[model samples]
Each structure stands twice: as structure tokens, then as C-alpha cells.
Target chain A: MSHDTVVTAAMLAIGDELLSGRTKDKNIGHLAELLTLSGIDLKEVRIVADDEEAIVEALNALRARYDYVFTSGGIGPTHDDITADAIAKAFGLPCDHDETAMTLLAEMYRRREMEFTEARQRMARMPRGAAHIANPVSTAPGFIIGNVYVMAGVPQVFQAMIDNVLPMLRTGTPVLSLAIACPYGEGDIGTPLAAIQKAHPDTSIGSYPRYIDQKFSTEIVVRGRAQAAIDAAGAEVHAMIGAIRRKKEVVENPSAEA
Target chain B: MSHDTVVTAAMLAIGDELLSGRTKDKNIGHLAELLTLSGIDLKEVRIVADDEEAIVEALNALRARYDYVFTSGGIGPTHDDITADAIAKAFGLPCDHDETAMTLLAEMYRRREMEFTEARQRMARMPRGAAHIANPVSTAPGFIIGNVYVMAGVPQVFQAMIDNVLPMLRTGTPVLSLAIACPYGEGDIGTPLAAIQKAHPDTSIGSYPRYIDQKFSTEIVVRGRAQAAIDAAGAEVHAMIGAIRRKKEVVENPSAEA
Candidate 1:
């Protein structure tokens, strides 16, 4: 079957703090979930250092491969925040102060009555021929140059910008998922699960084991775009699990009636 | 100031589920932290699909560039789990049953009195010249071929294997950090923080803003290997904040007692 209809996106998280273990990158999970719900498939995620070369390489590769690329971090007022410059270099464009971005920066400083220094004005730099992404919480707006969308690295500000930006993008058919969990090991149900996948070729069966309260249990998650097929596959899984549970009960207490 | 005595590492997460937004790859954070604690700098992280060609390409590039390369996932009993095969292809070695890995797998199945099928036996395959990595949680052991370490995809199992394997490798001096959060806006502290970073070229200072109860507060984090430098930098940061707070109090009660 042709899977050409799926809209794919990639995430790039740039910072040394994440690599140094000083900060945990939380944007990956939040963006992945947001894209999934919007029917956009996240195809790849890369975390690179604050260095210019690393960011440029990742940005070029992902932008060429995926339909859309979203990047977080290195967009603040500090000298180390070089995401805007890196994106410009990757796309072969000049990094300069855009009037649109400068307007927003000036408005924010004017409201606070703070003297905006040249260091603070550094936030207004954007790649040539790009649009600004609105930041509802903070004013240092993220910008989109071609397929690469660069935003602030901080989780709260990044999330707010995503919420404002995602609605403007095109989406594909959304994926649906069905799940079942019981006290069972994956090996005992592997054969039946494989058979279900073969019958419903469009669906994917994922087996995840959860350890809760020091007890092991497995959750069988089935995902597809078709609802009827999902129900049919889910029914087969339940029957197979019921059979195994009954057989175990019979062996444990031979005299007990079911 | 030659900072060239640093051991660097990169993590490659191989799984389509992570890319497809079905699973959040937790191993990257855990590995990043573990590597940093071991004094090995985690420089980059990449998450790709289970495709052999992609895995092989990433394996070659990262292994050639970094001091150490760690890969998680795509090493399992299913048809798509081809990490061992890909590593063999990257190294131009034959993929076959490793004697040590086979012994460990056999002992594990024997303890539980379970029959090891051909599918389960697939876990024993490794590169021709690779060595086995100890898996404390399960029998499907990880392997180390050259600079690359191939481990399980599951979080708990991979973490246990890392703890067992990392001590055997050489490490560098670990990094240290100090941070303080105050009720101040980033706009108020932006200039002074920039000055602190400029004054101390060896220390890296980061500013993070959080919105709590609809008010913005910023956290200033400073990091360095030297204790004396960090103490001096932290004192300057506090002094700056004290000055800002005092100004705010004076502006609020201008006609009160001096």
C-alpha cells in the first residue's frame, strides 16, 4: 500500500544545556503529541549542541527530507543563542534585522518602559524572506524561514508559539488507536498478535510492557485509520487473551469449575 | 585555555514509533545525564526509523566523529529489529551468533524453563568482532563493536546495561553548576547577565523564564568546573538582583521613610 498521504515533520532541539544534563529537553514530547493530534506525522527528532556547524547540518538534512521542520532553543538574547544565524547560513540567506520583528520587540520594550539595548535588539534578527511566529507569552517571536520554523528553547514559551502557529498549517487524515491491557507476557500472545497484523495489513500492533507496583503487565496498542478494522483486530486479541487465561486457570486448580 | 581534554559522546535512538509519535524516546535523557555524570560530554542525539540504511549511515558518521557512540532500540525478536545486522554491515563483518551472547541467552531461558525458538535466538546475533554488553534485567545482551555500543530499546533495561558498561571506559572531569531563581523579569536582568557571561569567558550563564500565577519570573543558572569561579559569579548575580529589588521598592514607596 502507498503511504504517500502521510504528512511528515521533524524536530530539532539545539542547546548545550540539554547535552550537558543541566536541562532536560521537554519540547520534543510536547511537539510530538501536538503533531500527532493534528494528523501530522513526526518523522525525526535531533538534538545538537549550540555550535553553529552542528545546528546548520541538522537543519539542512531535516529540511530537505521532511515536509516541515520545527526547531527549539538558541533563539534568546544571549550571545550563545545562534539559532537564527545558523538557520540563515543553512538556507544560504543573510541574517539581518527585519522590520516586522523589530516592531514587536520595540512594542514589548515600550510597554515595560525598559531601555532596549543592542543585545536585546539582537532578538529582532531574522533570515531574509521569512515570517514571524507569534509568541503569546513572551515577545521574542519565533520565525519561519522556508520549511524550518525556529522558536525559543524554553518549554512554556515554545508551547505557546506552537499553539498559535500549528493552526495555520495544512494537515492530513488523523490516525486512530485502540489499546488493551491485562496480566500477560508478550511472548504468550505474540503469535496471535502477528496473525492479527497480517489480516489487517493497514494496522500496526505495538506491544508495551508496564511495570506497576512491582508487577509486570503488558499493553497491546493497535493503531490504524480504519475504525472497523481496529475493532475486528481488537476482538481477536481479546479472544486470544481469554483463551490463555482460561487455560492457566484450568492448570492451576484442576477441580475448580469455570 | 585549552579545553581539549573532553570525552564526547552521541546517542542514536532507532525506532519508527518514536518518529511516528507513538512512543516518546526516554533513553536519550537518561543517557545524556549518565554520560555527563561519567564526565563524557553528550554532544548530539538523533532519532531515526528502523531502516537499516539510515541506521548504518548514522552509525558510521557518529562513531567516526565522537569519542563514543551509544544506540538504543531496533534490537529485539521482531522482523523489523535489525540493529545487529546494520552494525555488521557498517563494519563490513559477518552477522552471526556470538558464543558469549548465546551462552547468556541459553542460561536465561534455561532458568525459566522456556523453549528458545529461532525467533528468540535472533537476539544472539552480533558483529564478527564485537564484544557482549551485560544486560542485568534480561537475556538479550547488548554488544560493543569498535566505538559503538548497541543496547536494548526498553528504558529500564538500557539504563541497567549503561550502568554496568560505562565504568569500564575512561572519563574526563565532570562539570558542575549553580542556579538561583528570583521574582524578576528577564527584561530587568538581561543586561547584567550578559555582562557576567562576558566578564568570565570560562563560565557559561543561562537565563530561563517561567510564568507562575500569571507573573513572569526568571531563573539565572551559571555553570563551570571551578568552585571559586562559580562562587564569585553567583555572588555577582545576587548583587545585581539585590540592586534591582531595591530600586523597585523605592519606586513603589517614594514618599515614605528613607
Candidate 2:
């Protein structure tokens, strides 16, 4: 896509468990991968504790800066689930139990013969004018309010919300990424790779280093919106890797020429 | 720990791979858990793309707000690896090849019979007046400048750097945590849990819900610095869960009196 056609997004992950290291976040990666596939650039991500003020501040900052701000966590039925209220205050809207959400919860509870207690009812609350994002995994729906998508912290629920939300949002031209593996490590290829990157300013080349079986290996990923740009960069990186491999082989056996 | 004695930290993860979901971040979880165990509250985490301006802005913001700011990624031999340069700019310091780091790299490369090319030499560069965080997994070193720590993106290197850096930082009182398992889900226990939390404001109670075997379950964690406060809040939460379980059992089987 053209630079102006780029659709950018930011994610805010809200939970004390995540900040405390009690819960390893799975949603950020899930959301990021999906967004990238759908042609939205996940520009930034912020993980904050379940404090209301922090949520409000992050929500406001991210919502204003990106095309969409997707938040995971803090929408549960428990007391610590303050995301809905925080989003409400951030947008200067009243958060209350929405009749649509309340009805959804009520029906789900009745089918299971569970009481729709006040705690459960809290899940039905969202910022005013918010649209519901259906949760196929769970009964309580996530809400979309003014470009901010507030979803559950549970990995399954978060992914489900993304499934619902992705189809409805505006997406850019998908980013094309090609990965080339090289036996050479970063130290062996950094200079040539940088030159190739300089030659292809329109593409982004990333060098990922790995230690495998006591040998250093690297993966070169060339990403761009246009296929022609990606193909050009990828071919150059592959050729560079081959050249480095041959050079290293000749250095190891100087008598080969003789 | 008392409020005044609390030591707080923040983490900045710099890499396009992370934002692109090409890399699932392992450093954030490892750092968060270790910091929490070390009596440092990891208050926030930010993941930014490999953009120098983004890194500089996040570094300045986090370094000023928290006692310590830990960063992972972008300190590599490749061109995309610009974290050290960005950090230098953020702190208004000159970044150049450190004599100690260069010496270390030179000696290691010589011993391994590998060329210390310009690309390899790039790893030796760091911000002026920065202290080295040794990477045992790799020869390259991370650096600490002011309250900001710049580390590698690789998981093994990042963990090794943490092992070297954690011992030197100030810490708060270790937070005490107690978890109680409950068969009932959050909806069944949210109200009473809130009451228990309010009754012991000094402690933090977190409700983590799970769906297993098509049934709802939850784990309640009570955390505080004082053992007494944790025990007090924990006891209340335990008692409430038991009460809810008993009530639900009776409600489901009304013929039990026979």
C-alpha cells in the first residue's frame, strides 16, 4: 500500500496479573499476528497495571494516535475489572449496564440456569454508544466505543473478539514478508545486509539471530507492501547469504584453488 | 513494603519482529517474574517498532517515571539494531565503541579464529559513561546509562544480562502472595471478594477465571507486603468461596435433605 493508505493501530493490555508476571500475555501476539495478516500495522503496544488512572491515560493517548486501539483485560465480572469504567471516563461518557448487553448475559445465564447477579451484570456495562463485539467463546460481549475496542483478557475470548472485529474495520494493503535462512550469523552478514537495505529503502530488512546446536544461524526477513519491492530485497539477501557461505568455505580450505 | 519504600520499574521492548508478531516475546515475561521476585514492582511495559524516535520518546518517559527502566532488543550488529544509538540520544550522550567492550570482543573473536569485522565491532559501541551488562551467552555486552538498561533482543542473551544486572539494583520489600482455588467461577464469588478486598485495602486480591471441562473455575490470589494483611484477606476470601460452594451445592440438589 502507499504510505497514505497505511492503517495503523495500537494495543493496550490492562491487567495487574500481567504486570506482576502472574500471567504471561498471549493476546498481544495473537492480536499482532492477526492485524498484520489483515493489513493493519500494529504500531505499538502498552501493558499497564489494572489501575483506572493508568488505563484512562493510556487509552486516551493511544486512541488519539492510532486508527484503532484494542484493549485486552479488565472487563471481567470481578471488582478489579475496571476497564469499562475507565474507557467511559476517558471518553467523557457514562458507563452503565446496557440493555442489549444485559439481555445477552441474562439469556445466556438462564440457559445455563445461573443467576444473573450484579457481578455478572457488570460485564454488560460499557461506555455509552458502544457497539457490541460478540464473544462466541463466552456470553458477555466485548464493546467497541469510538475506535477503541475493549475486549476480555482471556486468550480465547480476545482471539474471538479479534475475529469479529477484524472483518469490520478498515485494513491497508497487506504487508508481504519473505524469510530467508542463512547459516551465517549477524556478524558475518550485517555489513552486506545493511547495504542491501540501503539499496531497498522501501522495504524493511530484519536480521534475527539464533543459536542452534552450538552454531550461530540467522533468518533474514524482508517486508514491504509491494511484491516487486519484497522480491527484489529477498533475492539480494539470498544472494548475499550464498556469497558469504562460499567465502567462508574458501577461507576454511585455502588449498581448494591449488 | 511500605509505600515509600517501594521500588518501581518499567520495560521497553524494541523490535519490529515483536510488533509484527514474527517473534513471540519471551523477555518480558522473564523480566517481569524476576523483577517481582526481587521486590521491584514492574509497573509498565511498552513495545515499540525499530524506530529511533519511538525508542527515544519511550526511554525518556519511562526513565523519568520509574526507578529503573529495562529495555530489550535492537543492540545487534545489523542496521536495524539502533537501540544503543537511540538510547544515547535519549540521554544526550555520545555513543561510541567502548574500550572495554571492544577489547572483550577482540579477544573473543581472536580466540575463535573469527574476523572482528566492522559489523562485529558495532556490538562494542555503547553510550558514554554507561556500565556494561555482561552477556555470557554471547560475546556482545549490553549497557546501562543513568536509570535505563539497554539489552539484546535474543532470549538467552536477555536472560543472561538480567542475571548480571538484577543483583545491582535497589529493591522493595518482597510482596507476599497466597492463592486459593475455587470450583466456582468469578460470577459466583465476585461480590464477596470485593468486600474482602475492601475490608483489607492494604492487600490486593485478584480473581483469575478458567474454563475447564465445560465448567467455570477460578483462582483467587491475595498479595501484600505484610503477612498478617495477606493472611487476613486470604482467610476472608477462602471463607467466602466455601460459603458460595456450599450454597450452590444445596441449590443444585434440593432433595439432599431426604
Candidate 3:
């Protein structure tokens, strides 16, 4: 409820598939970008296997440290889907079939004329005293217990659940960033850029190098909680890059300099 | 250099850009796939900011827990490039510019007719007694200290570093995987699949649900250390899927059953 202070969160991506490299995780990036834009700082991310002990250990550690913890994967109908059980273990709660969830799922299946099979009923399981995070894309639901929000591994379902959870949490001041293109690489601007970063301690300046068209170039991105700080640091970076370009041109061409 | 036992690994992705959503990391997946295929179990992955303390703490934790710890990012020419410092601190050793790295990088710049600038010189810094991981894409080499492999964050450079490091380390038996496509979703086969999983304790069975073409589908992936176990689980999974399909067809088309 409080937006005055930073809302820090961590992601626990639980799945053997992720660790085994069977699934190239897309949820981490998607959730990261959303959290950044929403002003919630995603401070850390931990990817662990589907083993319940592994999930419980990671979940407990993360939930205690960060304001909110988001977990994806392992809440489906299969036996391997033990995230719900893990969450309960982490919070010292009981995980069992919830009447509300079962009723909703049953109604949806009945409308579609599909039987609510025993395995499908597994989807109704949730941590005691947890609220359901709607998965609009699918009939099954993801739940929130304590600070942890359990979501599906499927990208579409995870994304939909993310949308449902984002509105309920607290957010901090959105970060403002400005990027300056430097025709030169980090080697060319690192010194001057470090000076600018030190001069504006409020701004965090980063130099990213790219090799394009057989030449190396860098992009200096200045980020800060406030606009003025980012602009101040960004201006210095732009001027520094301009000076380097001119100096290089002059050194390469003595006649042009004269 | 022992390939008899399972080699475990953890990746520490260091960068504020990754946390800020400015850069979506491709290194994690790339390295994960490579490690998996190399018979190394990438057990866990941690993404932290470029902060020195964060890097040092994560590096320490990972290096101690896993057989090998692979770190990507924050090893460059900029002031934010503090991975080398962190690695050195974690190992309780001095981090200084190495003569070998300096010589190699210096010659690389000289060959290209570029100045060996002070910022570029930062790339030569490494933990005392660390071995350089060759970067063919860019002459700026990554260093390996103890069991930890420090690599460039750029996908191309990270990949090149991975190739250099893989052959040097020991690996376990390659994991064999079999994926069976099930037209029905998890709800239809989750119970039977769980039974098959219980029957085959050696194999790890995973049910992945997909929302495709406005219908639910699932893929059951069976993974194991040996072919016989994978084959045994694979056969049961196939047979189970076939039986489900036949039963569903009979129920949907009563006239066809006659």
C-alpha cells in the first residue's frame, strides 16, 4: 500500500526443465521488464529445480528477503507440479483443494461440456488462506500466498497472471533513463564517463559496447530515480563523446586540423 | 578432470541493465543449453546487480556450492566492470592487471593500429593466478579463477568463452531426453503420467502444457541418465497418450465406436 519506499521483489523460477535447459525461460525477462516499468525493483532472481525441498528452500529464502516473491512453474496437474506444496511448506500453511477455485474451474468446464477430471481437479489445489490470481488465458488459476505469487510456467498464462498481480502491489518512483550514442567504444570513453558518474552520484552510468559493421561502438545509459540527475549525467556523456569524435578526426587527418 | 560424477554448475549474471529491463539477457539460456549438452548440470542461476558486494557475495556462495560457477557481465573497460575485483575479493586474492593479458590485448590493439588506452588496460585485470579464457570474437579475454569462469556478457563473447571452458572441465554422462506430443492437455493425461512417473523412478517426467491454436495441448518430456530408463518411460508415455486419444475419440463419436 505504501509507494513512498522502494518495493523490492525477487523471482523464483522453479522447474527442472529450466535447470536442465529443456526450456529456455522467457518469463524472467517479461516479468523483469514489467516490474521495472511498474516501479517495483526486481532485485534478484533465482532459478531452481522442481524438487519440493529445492523449491521450499529457495522460496523461504527469497520471501524473507524481498518485499514480494514471484514463482513460476510447477503448479499444474502433474505429480512434478509441487510448487503449491512447496509454498505451503515455506509459509507453514496447508495446501489443499480450495472450494472457490474448484467451483470456478468446475463451472468453466461444465460450460464447455468437459468433465472436471480428477487430474483437472488438481488445478483447484492452493495454499490455505491464499487468493487466486486470475489466468484469463486459461481456466485454471494461480494463487498468492503471503508475499509469494505462484503462477503457471506457460508464458501466456504467466503473463496474464502478472497483469492481475501488478495492480495489487505497492510501487516506487519510476526510474528515468537516457542513452547517449558514442561512435567510439568503452576504451574511448570509459575514463571521462567514470568521471561523470562520480560527479553525479545520484545517477548510475553504464557503458555497453556493441560490435556492429566490423566496428565497435558504445551506448552510455544514465539512469536515476529523478529526471534532473539522469539529464545532468547524460549531457556530460554526450559532450564527452563529441569531444572524442572530434579529437579522433583531427588526429587521423592533420591537414584537416590545420 | 573427473567425468564419472555429475558436474554441477551455477551461473551468476551480473548487471543492473538486466535488472532494470534495459537488456533482456540471452547469456543465461545460451550457457544453460551448452552446459546441459556438455553433461554438466546447471543447477541454479542467480542474477544480481553490478554492485561489487553483490557480485562478491553471489560469487562466493555459488563457487562454494557448485563444482563450477560461471559469471557473465561486469568484466569490461568501464568503472562498472567490477567482476574481476569481486572475483579477487571472493578468493581473498589481489586483483591486478596481469602481464600475460596485457601483452596479448596490447598486441591485439597494436595489430589494429589502435592505442592501448588505460580503459582497455582494465580488461587485463584479473585475480592473481587466474587463467585467461580466450575471446576470439574480441581480443579482450575473460579470466577463470579457481572453479569460476568469468565471461563477457555479450552473447557472442559469452558463447566463445563457454566453448573454451567446456573442454577444460570434467562432465558426467550426457542426459538423454524424449519428448512425446500429446494432443490432449495435462488434465487429460496428468494422472496416468504420474503413475508412469512413479513406476519409473529413475526417469524424470515433466508435463508441459501449451495453449496452441485456441486449444490445449501438452508435451511430456522424459529425461534420464541412461537410454534404457528413458526408453522405458518413453514407451509407457506413448502408450498412455494413445489410450487417452482412443478413449476420447470413442466418447466424442459414439457412432464411430459401433
* Number of the top-ranking candidate, with lDDT as the measure: 2
In angstroms, give how far residue A59 of model 3 lies from its true place: 1.3
Clash pairs, candidate 3, are none
Local error of candidate 1 at residue B160 (angstroms):
1.3
Evaluate candidate 1 and give its CAPRI docking class based on DockQ.
acceptable
Candidate 2 vs candidate 3: which has greater TM-score?
A: 2
Runs of candidate 1 exceeding 4 Å displacement:
A1-4, A190-200, A213-216, A228-258, B246-258
lDDT of 2 by residue, B81-132 (tens): 9999999999899999999999999999999999998999999999989999
Q: Which candidate number would show the highest DockQ if scored against the true structure?
A: 2
What digit string (tens of lDDT, one per residue) describes model 3 on residues B89-145?
Answer: 999999999999999999999998888889899999999999999999888899888
lDDT of 2 by residue, A217-250 (tens): 8999999989999999998998998888778778
Return the TM-scores of chain A for each candidate in numbered order: 0.95, 0.97, 0.96
Which pairs of residues collide in candidate 2? none
Give the DockQ (2 decimals) of all models.
Answer: 0.45, 0.85, 0.78
Best-first order by DockQ: 2, 3, 1
Per-candidate count of clashing residue pairs (backbone under 3 Å)? 0, 0, 0
Which runs in model 2 stand beyond 4 Å of their true positions? A1-4, B1-4
- For each candidate in the order shown, give its overall lDDT on alpha carbons: 0.82, 0.91, 0.88
**What is the alpha-carbon lDDT for the whole of candidate 1?**
0.82
Which has the greatest TM-score? Answer: 2
